[model samples]
Target: MSFEFIEVADMSTEADYEPKNIFLTGGAGFIGSHAAILLAKKYPHYNVVVYDKLDYCACIENLNEVMDLPNFKFVKGDICSSDLVTYVFKENKIDTVLHFAAQTHVDNSFGNSFAFTQSNIYGTHVLLECAKNCPTMRRFVHVSTDEVYGEGEDFDAKPMDEEHVLEPTNPYAATKAGAEFLVKSYHRSFKLPVIITRGNNVYGPHQFPEKLIPKFANQILRGLPVTIHGDGSNTRNFLFVEDVARAFDCILHKGEVGKIYNIGGCNELPNIEVAKSLIKILGKEKEMDDYITYVPDRKFNDLRYTITSEKLHKLGWKEEMSWEDGLRKTVEWYKTYTNRYGNIENALVAHPRMTGTSPTNI
Candidate 1:
């Protein structure tokens, strides 16, 4: 089945008569880029302004396709900068805000919890403050992750729901959980029109190669060994970037205020199985058993993270891409990057903080 990308025109006029002016943070990142593109294409009548810090995790190339679109504009700035964020709200006349910028690497967060707190916690606070002050701001959609629910080993059938107790394991998840609280607090005390979405691991094109799936795909395509943290039995639920993007559109347009939605995939696989699947898709199955190497796991690595997105599904959101299909497309995209870019050594150097911390060190 083909996926239906959401546009601004799709929102009912009864909710808000004028064409919406959207302010999106982290619009150049993986999932944000896709969402921006979909919004631009699907909602030709609306104006979409993107504000991003363009950190190591982001690239302007991600927005190349939508850069020239009439309704889309990008502003290079940080979310933590109150002056900059406030200026964006005032200058753009933004009707809604989609907050997506955050420090997301769990391992890195363990080494420097300060960075996570600054970006995830402080950055969110800045945006929330701006939205609260903007009388024109009708809604605020805060994007988050399922890692806030921590880990569990129940592979048989216990999926985390929206009501699940938050038990964040690492610094990254901890910071995100903190941010969620702040959003909720603002909604209750200040009456900010806010909603939150916690999703599973997201994979897709334009993703920086630090995460598991893309990292492994890039390495395997270059005939390099793949690293599996710990015994590789740890499992995670994966969602395609576009699916997560579409879920955001649903939440922004239809999700109830002061409510949190869990967006996740139906498929759950162990890390080792994920590696083997990539090998098969790359036609390197013979090297699957041999090319795999076990790296020491990160500090406080969660054993499993699964989510039940029934809340999002009930709100007319669904995962349209299957794991196999999504994996195939991801592999193809990474292959192109490898061939065109030659090597991403410079990109690695730019993000030195990522190299810090490992089970081998602490």
Candidate 2:
């Protein structure tokens, strides 16, 4: 919940200028864990240190496979704690910061605006300050979402690109957009080597069950109905988790400083269709309608989101997982996970770390 920066040896000056010691926040969460694992395995010489708050959405089991690795480390703390953030960078001599920490759930953000602002906006400012002071810092990759661009497709307009104006429609998107401005300001005023990324809807394994895919997947397994927002016609692009991880890696190493890149998947579909597809995957196609319940739309739901990843593509990045394949893999992962714990709510409520019954990962 909180961390204090004690007298750890100040090794910031001795850090290598490259990404030797990488500091990644939110690394225990869905996208962060995937990126952490990828970086840990792909660059064994670099110390992949994950700093996270271990929120309800964060699961230590997500990093079980990489927990014992020589170069992998995890610190438990909130990013809002500037002292803790600064200590992590100075103590670890962290040169590269992959910022993935934030309040990501859109619906939750509506009611918990303070949490989003504190974590997403102020938390980013804390990290940027620490990063700007680090002599060995190379890249500050600020991971963002396409929702910052507001609604995507218009009557005849094409997908939004990097140059599109930022008009975030919801509290969560507003906080993220505000964070992006902070990153850009740090780059402009302090000359921090920063690059920002805006990606469309991301879905895959290890994701907390709060999101649509995993939530609905478990609901279907329990023979319960899935909740559909509004008319469920709102559209979004879904990128696989691994693909987003690779995109982050490419941006960290190859992307231009002070640039913003859009990472988007090719697949675009309606929300109801996505739920129906999941039902079909579960062999409950005949019960699709029976298994879906219409709910009130989000307070400020975006009808659609479309962002082009042309800039990232130019950096030699390409999506290797098709939506169909990606969705299948995601559904299977949830199936295996549900089988192990019987349900996500039970697993989260019972997890020692999440329940605050034990010390979080070191």
Candidate 3:
């Protein structure tokens, strides 16, 4: 299955930037998989080399859609392994590095904070060091999270633009902020063409059930109680995975180097609202009282996270997926792809970190 590549004029530099061979780290995980499939299908001419360590929550099956594509290739390796990262860069002739690999779950970060630092901070360092040596490297887009901005008490308050200060409250978010500083340094000191993106919570089909949305959906599917932290008033801005994939595509083609873009979503729903939506979508709305169970909230759960995407909007990319439409699609996708993760018993647990579930939400 091939797709027509849309050519958007590169406005970031005087010289036009073209993406040919892309080295996509963490290409098998949720958002990464969506981006990988999009790049591989949309730009048939672009070679997508997907490298992943296949962490516990990251399933290899997620990349099955693009496995047979001639332009797509997968390499099982750790980004922290400097030797392996360098070899992949040289062998694939990778011109662009989409750094998507990281330990990304907040719940697990509290218990396993060291792993987050190693992968989010040290792994990013390894990629920057390797990309610096590659003459062909043109772009290094680091994927950051909105959580780095910490809590936003007022839902109607001024949105956090790229210039907003990063006040991460959790170990997971702190590590991502630390990694962003490194990315900034490499661009300033070494002059490596780089861009940064900080996006809101993403909900979609391939997501491991460790997250709030998928976790609730999975628990409901098994006729188990849908657990909520605290009273479930904590809110998150959500973007459909497909929408985020396109946002990255826009940044890849037309985004300015050495700049940060906040990929904001219009849908800002609280946790309980999300749970209720999923239950309704799955035809279990009548049983909401039984399925909805409240659990102790995380040690430092942020009340809200908000960001403005005016910069990305100027890039001709606004989210096309509406909340109702996107949520229904996500629930439907989860229904069909439930078995994608063989035995999601651990991921379905309310507190994966306490139960030895090793997922860093990315």
Models, CA RMSD each: 6.3, 7.0, 5.4
Error of 1 at 73 (Å): 0.4
Candidate 3, 97-197: lDDT as tens digits: 99899888888889889888888999999999999999888889999999888899786878988878888999999999999989888876778888899
lDDT of 2 at 175: 89
TM-score of 2: 0.89
**Candidate achieving the largest TM-score:** 3
Rank candidates, TM-score, best first. 3, 1, 2
Model 2 residue pairs with clashes? none
Write the residue-wise lDDT of candidate 2 on 163-189 in tens digits: 888889999899899998888778767
Runs off by more than 4 Å, candidate 1: 1-19, 339-362
Root-mean-square deviation of Cα positions for candidate 1 versus the true structure, in angstroms: 6.3
Location of the lowest summed lDDT over 10 successive residues in candidate 1 = 353-362
Q: After superposition, how far is residue 338 of candidate 3 from its true place, in Å?
A: 1.0
